[model samples]
Target: MVTYNTMIHGFCKKGDLYTARRVLDRMKDSKDCLPSTVTYTTLIDGYCKKGELEEAMKCMSEMNKQGCLPGLFTYNALIRGSFNKGDIKNAQKVFDEMTCKRDIITYNTMIHGFCNNGDNYAQKVFDEMTCKRDIITYNTMIHGFCKNGDNYAQKVFDEMTCNRNMITYNTMIHGLVKKGDLDTARRFGLNEG
Candidate 1:
């Protein structure tokens, strides 16, 4: 069963959905083993990454019908695919439909999506997250703000209590430079010394 799952994952990662589906079909034929949630997730993620959202959604529905509970990782992939296509409505729909507790990755995907869409939704998600946020969370906001040329990235930097790393510093510097805030960038760059 594990081997079957691995084969599915390999085909999916290779973006050969047909072969992946064939492997899944073979799995379904065997009475000795049942496909797991991880199997469906790999297929959904592959389809989403390939921009085949319809197929992904179908797999998601099938996954649920097969008694496989789609978890945060699967939900995140769907949200990301929606965001990749600038479809916030669908993204939010999937987000709202999440039956499991969301983690930082889920919120980060939302923030990154909203940021890419030029909305302030990230702030709301950032505030509402009940889980412990890591540097990736902070970096997402900072990078988003910097990409949008907004000085608000600095405020997010200020909010980080600890775990600041080179990525954080580089994002801030790059953002400041992108926004033409060279003087402020200089001040920040000096801090890195």
Candidate 2:
């Protein structure tokens, strides 16, 4: 199984999905080893990174048919793939399907996706997240709001009294500078320094 997975990973890494699929088929036919969730997830991630979403979805279906339930990484890959393809509808569908199983990564992915597309749904996802927000989650929201020219970035920044990383400081400063508030940016920078 490890050998088969390594072969699949190698082919997928090379973007030779044809060979990857062939390896998967060979794994399916192997009597001693079967494809695991990791195997399917790797192939699915490869397809997603290549923007071959149809093939990724097919791999997902095959994973399910094989009685291997998709895990958090699997769902995250699908959501990111949909977002990368600018298929917001499909991204939302996948997100909605995750329902009760969403972690901070899922919410962060959705936030980043919506923000990258200049969509306002980032806030909705941010507000809807029930899980504990990591620094990545906060940074993503701050960056998104800043990108959208929304004041919510400052609000989020101010809320992070304890967990502010360099990224948080830089993003807030950059946003202020971009908004033509150089005085505020300078002051914020000086205070942080």
Identify the leading candidate in terms of lDDT: 2
Best by TM-score: 2
Count of clashes, each model: 0, 0
Query: How do all models score by TM-score?
Result: 0.87, 0.90
lDDT of 2: 0.89
Candidate 2 residue runs with Cα over 4 Å from true position:
none
For 141-193, candidate 2 gives per-residue lDDT tens digits of 88988887899898887776357888988988999989998988998898652
Per-candidate RMSD vs. true structure? 2.2, 2.0
Cα lDDT of all candidates, in order? 0.87, 0.89
- Candidate 1 positional error at 26, Å: 2.7
Q: Which lDDT value does model 1 have at 38?
A: 89
